[model samples]
Target: MNAPAYENGRLALMLNEPRLPTIGRFWPEFAERSDKEGWQASRLLGALLEHELAERAKRRIERHRTESHLDPTKTLATFDFGMVPMVSKAHVTALATGESWLEKGATILLFGPLRAGKSHLGSAIGHALIDAGYRVLFTRTSELVQKLQAARQSLQLPSALAKLDRFDLIILDDLSYARKDQAETSVLFELIAERYERKSLLITANQPFSGWNDVFPDPGMTVAAIDGLVHHSTIFELYVESYRRRKASDKQSAPATITMEARQL
Candidate 1:
């Protein structure tokens, strides 16, 4: 029945209390509505709290998506599951929910040749995971390797990895594109080893596990990295024709491509 004094409310705002802004904005309307409709105080408070929580959730989802570095255009809605028959829509949907593998710190490997929708699928799942309130980071394998190498040079590798540890999931796109340099591969292995069983990884690669030898300098390290990755992992082998090539072919087959000369005639 009692309300905080104006000075006390100002102090709460200065102290940055949660939901105070929402309460301040809605309390008068809520009171008026309750009085007019004979609503209970408990019901009004519950509605206000629910609204505050929903706002907080929306802000958190926005922050996660911005920090994730995922491609905005690539999302589950845009991904054509029928076009990539090699990939299972059910399996992708399950993973996108970030329930089983992501929770258990397992890996999801998308293996296929170029333009097989690997990057799109991985990024779409990253977006889904972001919506599901999971922190995610999407980076190209080469860019990540370069960052690690730079961190090693600066003697800040530990700090870098520690910062990376904050993310629940990391989407490494195009894993096989990174050059097979010893320094780069070493730090890449360190990242894999550090996150082993601690965080989840979603990788899109153009090469299979056996072909990873071309990406690593030493066979032993390659095996170790592969072991750590696949020990608790789900592999999706996408062996369809290149999506880009198919699109090009469709464009070529379209009837709208008549020459300007023909139109003029």
Candidate 2:
């Protein structure tokens, strides 16, 4: 018998031919069909495996807090840099491009008044470093003192400082916000000394080095801490009106308030 007109040869002939077993029972045709389905299934499984692996990597970063040791407390969601000077999207892009924000043991000082976006800038940088697979630690100046106090009582000060090195970026937010005693100021300096050449730091304060003594309590230690940080750091001073207060005023004067929902395109 002549083969089917569309036949390429034996394989096509089998798929196209009428047979005793019927079209559904054509073994060669079914075999080829099964193979194609299997190939597709294999591809689907491979893609699933890759996705799972990526998820696991993210989880590992979350778990270690030190493996790329990023802080879980990044304030990226709270910051909106509208009219604030110093940090910008361009700065973050450069960071993501692998530029070192903290270079060669330099300190970074972000000074401004309350609600001046100081913490926001530091938090944003921390998030950026995390995305770039670098470790970051975030804490307010007061929180850091509390941690040091606890570490001291437990005789874990050195160990705690050792763990601090696990992060590539260390942010001491809200420095000079609340006043502190002598011992606390000493502890703060020690932590900085520990991180000096070993890692990077981001210090945010309401006042500059000259006014640090007002918050630090101990003049000598405060001066030393300021020296340690400023000796090798860049300082960004924000001298604008508080965005927080401005928004509050706007909301109060508005006839109605509206909340917007984020939509996927």
Candidate with best TM-score: 1
Model 1 TM-score relative to the real fold: 0.87
Which 10 consecutive residues of model 2 have the lowest summed lDDT? Answer: 256-265
TM-score for each model: 0.87, 0.68
Query: lDDT winner among the candidates?
Result: 1
* C-alpha RMSD in Å of predicted model 2 compared with the true structure: 12.5
Model 2: lDDT of residue 172: 83
Candidate 1 per-residue lDDT over residues 1-265, each given as its tens digit: 8985556467457535654565666666776798899998799989878777787789889999999988899999988887788778898888888877776789999999899988888899999998988999999999999998999999999999999988999989998987658888899999999999889998989988888988897999989999999999989888898876876787786755566557878
lDDT of 1 at 59: 88
Worst 10 residues of 1 by lDDT: 11-20
- For model 2, what is the error of residue 185's alpha carbon versus the real structure, in angstroms, after optimal superposition? 1.5
lDDT of each: 0.86, 0.68
Shift in Å, residue 80, candidate 1: 0.7
